[model samples]
Target: MLKFFPEEIEFKVPQVMKTTKWIKSISESNGYKLGELNYILCSDDYLLEVNKQYLDHDYYTDIITFDNSEEEDKLEGDVFVSVDRVRDNAESLNVPFETEFRRVLIHGLLHLMGYEDSTDELKLQMRAKEDECLMLF
Candidate 1:
């Protein structure tokens, strides 16, 4: 199951059915099954608090994913997205808000799939995969 909630914000994912279907397709195509995935949209401040409390990192980030899957081939996680950061990133990157927002959405999913961005090579690979998945959107 896939769900989206706005935390301390008044936002809705643009296309609920289409977006959910696309996300599931991405997971299945990547050899993983979609489990209980939740997306929480909130302000940067709200996410910053979560970062501090959960991650012990006192900084702002676009997305923070908590993978809670018990099976190897299934994905279950809570993906936290900062709407404020997404809007700012869209403006700074000269892309539409929707585009950047979708990127962030898939970025979290990719992370749940075991993709990492701790190094330049890994970051490049992650970006390429994100672009490929974005094209499917």
Candidate 2:
């Protein structure tokens, strides 16, 4: 089961369709019998605050995933995505909003799946995994 929380925040993201597609693909690719997953799309300021508070990072980022699952096969997490950053990155990368947004969503899920991007080599591997996952969409 997949759900959106709070029920108040209006998700006007144009890439929502693609994001859903990508999420499903990730779940399948990881061989996880997916359970409930939640997504919260917010502004850059909101995500930056989350990053600083939980991650101790003062910089803004595209997305953050909080895994709540008790087992690897049950994919459950709260994914906080910055729609504002997605838009900015889309413009900077010369890609469509849906493409960049999907990329960010996959990036977050990969983190939940124990993939790290803190180092240059790891970032490359993560990007490769992202591309592989993106191909499933």
Candidate 3:
């Protein structure tokens, strides 16, 4: 199941239904099933606390994925997204907010699919996958 909640934002997603279907399809196409995927939208401060508590990092990021998948082919996790970061990143990247928003969502999904972005090589591959996935929209 896919669910979305606002942890620190007071709002509703415009195209939630469509986005959910797209995420589900992305999982299925990668030979996996989506299970209990939750998206929490929050502010930078809220996410910063989460990062410091869970990841022990003092930096801000667009999205943080807490993986809960037990097997290789099943994707399950909590993806926390910072709206503040998304807005800033979109502006910095010179792209529309909706476009960068979708990119961040898929970026989290790609991580759940066993794609890493730690090393330069892996980051490039991950970016390629993200770009490929974005074209599906």
Candidate 3 — worst ten consecutive residues by lDDT sum? 8-17
Candidate 3 pairs with clashing backbones = none
Q: In candidate 2, what are the lDDT values of residues 47-97, reduced to their tens digit?
A: 888999999999998888999888867788888988888889999999988
> What's each prediction's TM-score?
0.98, 0.86, 0.96
* Strongest candidate by lDDT: 1
Count of steric clashes across candidates, in order: 0, 0, 0
lDDT by residue (5-102, candidate 3, tens digit) is 99968856658988889899999999999988998999999999999999999999999999999988889999999989999999999999988898
Would you give me the overall lDDT of model 2? 0.81
lDDT of 2 at 25: 70
**lDDT of prediction 1:** 0.96
Ranking by lDDT: 1, 3, 2
- On TM-score, the candidate that comes out on top is 1
lDDT of 1 by residue, 1-137 (tens): 99999999999898778888989999999999999999999999999999999999999999999999999999999999999999999999999998899899999999999999999999999999999999998
Task: For model 2, give the 10-residue run with minimal summed lDDT.
Answer: 4-13
Instruction: Please list the residue runs of candidate 1 whose C-alpha ends up more than 4 Å from where it truly belongs after superposition.
Output: none
